[model samples]
Target: MFVARSIAADHKDLIHDVSYDFHGRRMATCSSDQSIKVWDKGDNGEWNCTASWKTHSGSVWRVTWAHPEFGQVLASCSFDRTAIVWEEIVGESNDKQRGQSHWIKRTTLVDSRTSVTDVKFAPKHMGLMLTTCSADGVVRIYEAPDVMNLSQWSLQHEISSKLSCSCISWNPSSSRAHAPMIAVGSDDSNVTYGGKVQIYEYNEVTRKYAKAETLMTVTDAVHDIAFAPNLGRSFHVLAIATKDVRIFKLVPLRKDSSSSAPTKFEVQVLAQFDSHNSQVWRVSWNITSTILASSGDDGCVRLWKANYMDNWKCTGILKGDGSPVYGSSGQPGALSGVLGSAAAQSALNGATGR
Candidate 1:
């Protein structure tokens, strides 16, 4: 029942997003401070910072690791109005002339003019496609790293009618089970008081995109959305963050004998809960899909569990480990002492086999 002490409180500004690689051996975090930090889990079960790099001129909003085969690749976006791909290069040959140990850079792909709020690599086809949402109210799809040049990539298409997409999530089995479906939600606006949520389908036959004909709109601005990660055993479900967190089962469109074409599938709201006082900012589910974690502007992290009825009920809240507070809120300070204390504590615990 204890919260793991793995992440460090290193960001000066608020952390917007965090992601773990497929193997769960490495993790990355992006913050409003305009930087991305990488952490590696050691054999002793401690999370240690392996590298930190400035990836944007403005606040970096989100970061996601590529999955499937290209495990080490990362995609990040920022308020500076750009999205970049970062991959950890192994050898000294790939490093800059400065002889840096690890090298990272901007991938030449779908760069945006307005702030890029979120970017995610499709889980099934890691190197094939990446999807991004921005303040410009667009959801654009771009090809992943090009095999030939590696540096050059192109934007294949864009969806331009969204109203400031707050977040997006792609179905993991979209390539095989489903057909590359993405659910996106917008910020609350006066026109749509309930907010807007749209599910898009990628047509392999025509190589075009279309909105799911029937059951894909919501009444509230989506704060954050996530497709269930563990796909095979269970039905495809999407968890969304808003005034109240909602979980929906996405039933794929089935063609009836009378109707030649597939109909818009129906969505069943599984559970609803109002857990945060302020706007909920992020939602993450583990591979089990039984446990859910959410964070918001209230500066608290809460954990929830799914019941037999598919209802999400709060399980517990994670409290800080009472590590020493370092600096005054008004003054800038170094994070060395705080980091050292945490690392030493972890090392000591590991040594004692606690």
Candidate 2:
């Protein structure tokens, strides 16, 4: 079971996204107000606003933290058609800070002509790589050849999905047996495309990313998508938010040495839930990939987990103010943070990650 907690996020406009740092000790939020706020957990377990500043000219759509190994770095995308990297400096002041902690803009990514919808940093194992998707259906990947030089980034590759993209997630598997993979979801209203989610894999032969698989069954407009941490599993698990909350497991099929084809997957729908009875906006997985939390138009956050038989079902529901909603899915349970540094799982802004 799970419980909810409320935060007084003081944004002038609609809050769009919240992301927790690697250690779960810090949280960052972005909004249509075009500003980002950083909160630090105190010794008493309460979160305090550490820094808040305007980072973009237009509405900020999403914000994500790079792995702690890369330093205190953040990437945010905006409707202004740019994605920017921000780095925290200890001595600088933002004027609103209680201390001298502040964040400085490192670089601005200006490749997208349309609103940049989502931005994500690659897995810690992938070096300092970043990916951003735009409303024009284009995905751009950038790499910082030198992690110390955050201002200099090389646009490594650009891929066009041909469908207006909404979100993108990198597969965080450290296993060398598989090539780097990324899943992209589209929010295009037209269902004629047949499939709204596409998985791409890096091709060493061509030194580029190639389409590996398409989740043809998901025909609706997808608002969010996430790849669960592999955790030594032979297959990959993905959670998606559309009209429903769905989970799929993709097991790789052995490849023939002579064939020049990419790896194929045996796709299976592990679970699907329309509990919200309306459009689901965002989905997120716990650090262990065992539990998933989703938010929808009903203004509630629901948690899903698998039983011993591997049957995924609702484990809890969090209503407004972090209270456990009285329902079949929720019992009078104890309060718990999904992750030690869990951000909003969110209802106000939108859930993205743990």
Candidate 2's residue-wise lDDT over 1-354, tens digit each? 343456788889888888888887888889988999998888977778888889999999999999999999999999999999999987555454366467899999999999999999999998999999999999999999999999999999999999999999999999988889999999899987778999998877778888889999999999889999888988999999999999999999998744546779999999999999988888888888878878988877777889899998786677756677775554543236663233244444553321
Highest TM-score model number: 2
> What lDDT is obtained when candidate 2 is compared to the true structure?
0.85
RMSD after Cα superposition, model 2: 2.6
Give candidate 2 regions above 4 Å deviation: 1-3, 92-100, 257-260, 328-330, 333-344, 351-354
Cα lDDT tens digits for candidate 1, 1-354: 132464554878776666777776776777877888887778987887777877888888778887736536788887788888877776746444443337467484446778787788876554567889887888889874554343666787788745777678887773355667787877646444543777777766656667773223467556678887654733577777666667777666565434323337667877776766765656677666666666554544555677787566775543234232233464322222222221222111110000
**How many residue pairs collide in each prediction?**
2, 2
Worst 10 residues of 2 by lDDT: 339-348
Candidate 1 segments exceeding 4 Å error: 6-9, 93-101, 174-177, 213-217, 233-235, 256-263, 320-354
User: How many clashes does the backbone of model 1 have?
Assistant: 2
Model 1: per-residue Cα lDDT at residue 115: 79
